[model samples]
Target chain A: MTDRRGTDERLAAWLDGAMNPADAAAFEAEMAGNPALAEQAAAWRANDRQIADALAPLATEPIDPEWLAQMGLAESTAVAPAMPPAANDNPAWWQKRWVPVGGALAAGLALVLLVVGRPPEDPQDGGLSLALDSTPALQQAQLDDGRMIEPVLTARAADGRWCREYRIGDVAGLACREPQGWKVEAEVEAAPATKPDEIQLAGGTDNTGIAAANARLGTADPLGAADEAALIASKWGDR
Target chain B: MADPGPDSQAMREEIIAVLPRLRRFCRGLTGHAENGDDLMQSTVERALGRAELFEAGTRVDAWMFRIARNLHIDAIRSVGRRGTQVDIDEIAETRGEDGRETVENRSDLAAAQRALQALPEEQRSAFLLVVVEGLSYREAAEVLEVPVGTIMSRLARARARIDAVVGRSQGTGND
Candidate 1:
């Protein structure tokens, strides 16, 4: 094979877009005349696509605490309030990276405390308790009698067995994957995030932060503290 | 640049936008699902931490990729005397030409990935930054702290070497 006039690497370089418009134009002309170089470029791009496809399949997956801990982004003592961002803000690719990955990663933490057991005798430590999986990247989760209770998400209501969401605020919502997908077994308004076990829906205060009741749970209204134990038995199917 | 806060935010945005592409680059570099995510995580962490270091309106993706390349290099060097070997079956396990699980003429893909890993760091870096990452010659030179001309020649040699290796796999490359 006759060696091309320019280096093989130069063509590779051109593909990366390192050249000036003038140089790029020149390179294009060279490519126009050299079918071999064109073919090589095509193959390189295909390889790139294949490699990329193999990577980052979990963009939509919640940013787990495990990943954050690996990066050293330890949670800060002072949780900064969400003030308005800069005026000339242009949305960045990296920041938006979170959206396609799963726009609802941090689903609103809507919580409701249920005592399905005889109501806790002591009003103080006495109800279904909820807490976020302190694990980094854990959108939010709860602890129920030492069991990890998470919101369930699923393609079908019966499948709603395991997905969970957390409301960071009225507008912000986040969800996390449950091994069993998500379920809306029994209708329960998630309690306030701060008070996991003893949450009672505040009367008429904006319910924006409330976790919307899933239609499949089939309960007309929210569940009472009396029904917790039996609700956990159902299963949800994944799409 | 005392926190070109606007620029910082902009850089972050730009980097996030190219995440899929960055992910693609990481996959090519790592050749495995877990390794790719780890590499990407490392690169993204570095980019976020060093976002201030990036010049206003600079090539954010290129900057992030440089970090990825360095991490991969450091990993290879750390393994010392032993390099990461990609399974030829992985290429087939991945996608195929006819969309089948068959290796589909990819005896060369694994060989290519291994050959890429085996190159002298400089040559490999130059080659991948250009070929796999799609960086321009000058841009790659900038990222590697080398001259443009050096990048061009290195790339030339890299391709020739890869061609020889792949050709051997295909039993067609003129050695």
Candidate 2:
């Protein structure tokens, strides 16, 4: 039974060309004597071909100019009128150019506000930093000021800083743990819930500002609740 | 403005050359063209933003694939909570770009995608990296951050699952 399973595994490795020349030769010789094994190998090969053929269009399709522009490699001939200036000077230039394209005017305004509203301050002063540091998604904690705060998502930004999106009352914002402190990246006023019962839904309000903030940070999808809890437990660095 | 220098320019060119395959790999992961493109865009942005971290003498395609895969896994986890659904009809519509695509070809493509989506994400990713993207098993293992043996096992199971799915579908059609 063990030998059969080993041979079965070898079939895959051999088919994938992962086997050395001698092992491949040995497998071929074995297959020549075993018609069933040969047939199964053939079937798998045919299936691979079908999958490759079906997915070929994805490789062949015209590359989107917006994608190229995002990488700062926009073709000279491509009609990318909205392509942001290839400015390496400002790190947040893409946020300014691309975030508003989602048509979230309020979120755009909030991003602008974040830039000029205040200098960097330690969030710990507001008693909000502890919650941002420790709370997982969908869980609420009371701030020292007695206001409720809920962490919506946690992600690592491209700059390798850990960031979290949270809601305090009707205001939603993103803050990254910088060397100095938790710096608020963007903030927008969330829509009020009509029914008190409706407030508990996860990310109930589709605040485009937070979404744009996530995109600007180039975060992978928000970490799952379990992962958020793990990160929080580790004090946000071990993972 | 100062010239960005030779290394930065070379990296940019390499990334541009790998875009199509990266986009294809992203599409395979997301199972939707638009979502795939969105993920691809994000991967490119992240890669470019951190180009200095990209080590010299490493395969650019492999590095980019790793970035794309990590982002996809993150997106998948978040989507699990969001309860978002990919529209199957959109798959058919998007593939209709070539006016000459026959009903048979479209169904084949849809069937292929369905078979792919049926597997777990890990298995699907392995199959794509090795079979579709043509990465060597060693390269795929590196991209996935797993042992080469794990890649072999995943590929074996993926092949079996896909064969079962495609075989059953064909059998049902004949019946």
> For model 2, how does the per-residue alpha-carbon lDDT over A1-239 read when each residue is reduced to its tens digit?
77766776799999888999999999999999999999999999999999989887666455555656645775422322232332222112123322323233323232222331234566444556776877788788755433467877788999898988777755667888866667788765543323333222222222355666676778776788788888888887744
User: Model 2, which residues run further than 4 Å from truth?
Assistant: A1-4, A75-239, B1-3, B81-105
- Model 1 residue runs over 4 Å out of place are A1-7, A20-63, A74-239, B1-115, B118-120, B127-139, B159-175
- Candidates in order, TM-scores: namely 0.42, 0.54
User: How do the residues A43-140 of candidate 1 rate in per-residue lDDT, one tens digit apiece?
Assistant: 65554454323332323233344544454432321124343322222111111222222223133323232211122122222111223212222233
lDDT of 2 by residue, B80-172 (tens): 565545343233223332222222236667677777776778888899999999999999999999999999989988888888877887888
Write one digit per residue (lDDT tens) for candidate 1, span B115-136: 5544455776676666656677
Most accurate candidate by DockQ: 2
The TM-score of candidate 1 is: 0.42
